[model samples]
Target: MARASPACWPAPACCNADFNEARLERYLVLAHAAGITPVVVLTKADQADPAPYVAAAQGLSQGMAVVALNAKSGDVAALAPWCRAGQTVVLLGSSGVGKSTLANSLSGGTLATGAVREDDAKGRHTTTARYLLPLPQGGWLIDTPGVRELQLTDVADGIDVLFADLIDLAADCRFRDCKHSVEPGCAVQAAIKAGRVDARRLDSWRKLTSEEVTNSQAMVAAKTRAAGKFTKKSAAKRRPN
Candidate 1:
């Protein structure tokens, strides 16, 4: 079943990469949970090898479509097969990754792409600012901000989707609650036993999950503190009356 997701995280909030992978991945995962399937576009094709990146993304996203081409004058029509009526696709990427270039191409080569600095090839952000571009054919694409750090708060299943292999292996642990640490009959351990699942993948999943849980707790605490302060301010204001 499609998981329940909140709308606070709009599609436009995706990170291209010039920012941080963890952040971009989080936003993308949220979008996925929220029922928005993203087309992973590997920008800066001239500079970066889109193959390895797309390969990793496909492995993480599981059946999600990823297309890599020069957005400078490239057409997204090749990616059209994946789109259907009333779908929302967001373009996320780093600054020099040519997000605008691809957006312009998708927009029929009319969007004035914000140019990046030559010294570092960094674009002036706030250029997109959550603008929704309509595809002449159908559907819409949301261009979002450049994300620097993506802190996980409510992403447990998203991690599983991003790391399906580890999750699938996790199910068969000797104990249902095996932490995959060093259990006697841990399925994950057996994979490590069979030399199939790399320990790095498990480590990455654990790191992301732990960090997300911690971040969620801290955010809740901060919100409580802020609410207390706000309540105090309101009480003082009412006293004058």
Candidate 2:
């Protein structure tokens, strides 16, 4: 049930688009929905201030852990707790985000590195495959390639968990099925009007939820068509000449 997702958003017509931040938010929501603790690592902190990104990541979901590091030389002891005995950690990020560099640092492996383009800050795929390594502390590290396209299906649970505040606000809406778009007595819209909620956060929730429904429907339709084709083929095979 996979579909091709757009590489860039907002302005797909633009020559270069950076959708990493938005994708990161979606991933955080998915992680929370899946009951996995998310640790957001902002690499290349030495090159520039990671404060803004760290702040935004924290704002995505309550109690999400975020760390900024130079990956190449930063102290990784902060990540030690997640590497405790019998614990398995997975690193997910876009290409050139320093996942490999951090993985090498933590696991003591010389994973190759690549330089990001100066113009766009995009990097080549240095780590083409996934690797499992033993950490110095007593756990396992699974490093994967940076994802380019991620689609969500039936992800309302994840969105609900991440946007609990919004859900609570929606509970006070005038109607149980309020769409929050031009609807009367919409508490979510009221929160936006009162500056209590970021308009962008509400938009993200709507986008994810709508996309999930669309993806789910598409998947179901595809499966139904496939089953129909299979039935037709089976009937033909059973028909005697």
Candidate 3:
């Protein structure tokens, strides 16, 4: 019968980038939109060269802080200030992005993590629930179940900050409503043609925008239906005042 008020906190406190740069875009987008001001601490540093990962993330995040974390070595404190008190943060990324591993590192203990088997491409999901663990100094770490598909929930306001090039180009488009696709005066397309914008980045932006629209629609529908169903009985039991 009623719409819930908007949440004022960032969620899932941990985010894993893995090999997907686009996913990081979504995560950072969500973080920035929530006013969380994320300091990205990347895990699984020993698995591969994290320099490229850092570079890729820097490209998406501009000046957002990013640190390569090897939890086993106890280097997670590099993200201390962000995780300090007076803040609630969420970790989001695909499975095996070391969400749990980093949590264990921050909390200082052995949390379960399934190693990637020699043959199978999937990893064992060790974190079955989302829980907040208090940091030794202060603050909390909220670890979540690794999601294969991160449907954009509340990050629409962050697209511009996360994808600044596209935003800047749109400002210069001849037509105010330029769609970036074959709209004659679309500056985004012009940038793409001139090698000023990476086609892949443009495509990623399109894909994320589409997914955000779809996810927003789906969430609204689901919430509306649930509200209707849950309140029907209440209406019948209502007493005249």
Candidate 4:
């Protein structure tokens, strides 16, 4: 999964303090769980300092590939490795991060582009539909509308993969079921206190875990409600009255 965001893209601060952090981390978590290779691309690099955003993104997923580019420059050849022949890459990110622009550059399609809101740096939903197109470099590009909210489901494996380093540290904890929070013998916490691991990264891990559980439960509840509705409808239709 290639997760992208603009280097200096503005986001609704009241809605979410760090828009890129929240969105990019969620995508990375989901992608890792699905065994997908995550490439964090910071578009509009030419417009702003891509370093901090790139660092923040890389911190979320160590060893993951990250790219910074000016999408409009049509110089996305850096993404060629993923767009190789017979390979299919899906564009995933919020609106205005340049998925459509990148798709156009790679696939030679004339998709409409939109300007990001000056107030919040949010881009309009330019790519309204999902479509697959042939890449000039011998691959397929699936461009879909920018998602407002990305609710993760059944991504336990991805979490493990994303936080493998922390997981490895957790195994050395004195207790078998260490929560890694306020545990006396928690190696994970030791690493944090020792400046070996960023406290923010640990917080991110915990946050994502909680979100997955919450989302999974919500999905189950939704299905249950839908099933109940169907059952009632079927019973009513079968009634002689």
Top candidate by lDDT: 4
| Cα-based TM-score, every candidate | 0.76, 0.86, 0.79, 0.83
**Would you list the C-alpha lDDT of every candidate in the order shown?**
0.63, 0.74, 0.68, 0.75
* Tens-digit per-residue lDDT, 1-241, candidate 3: 0113111122222223336667667777776666556565667676667787777666666677778867667677676666666544466666666777777777765668776544643456778898777777666667778777666765688776778879898898989987788888888999889987778888888888888788888899999999998799688789576
Q: Write the per-residue lDDT of candidate 2 for residues 1-241, one digit (tens) a residue.
A: 0112111010010012332457776777666656566777777666666677677667777776777766778467777878866676777777767778888998999988888777887767888899988889887787878677789886778888888999999999999999898999999999999998889988888888889899989999999999999999999999999
The residue pairs found clashing in candidate 2 are none
lDDT of 1 at 130: 66
Per-residue lDDT of candidate 4, residues 1-241 (tens digit): 3334211111111112223676777787776666567787777787767677777777777777887777767658888888867577777888877788877877889988888887877888999999888878777778888888987778978888888899999999999899989878999999998998998778878888888889889899999999999999999999997
Candidate 1: segments with Cα more than 4 A from true spot: 1-24, 46-49, 73-75, 82-84, 114-128, 193-195, 234-241
Report the error of model 4 at residue 83, Å: 0.9
The TM-score, computed over Cα atoms with residue i paired to residue i, of candidate 2 is: 0.86
Q: After best superposition, candidate 4 residue 142: deviation in angstroms?
A: 0.9
Taking the tens digit of each residue's C-alpha lDDT, what string does model 1 give over 78-164?
656544345555665554556666666766645556666777656666444767777665756666666545667877667767778
Give the runs in model 3 whose Cα sits over 4 Å from its true position: 1-18, 222-241
Ranking by TM-score: 2, 4, 3, 1
Question: How many residue pairs clash in model 3?
Answer: 9
Clashes of 4: 3
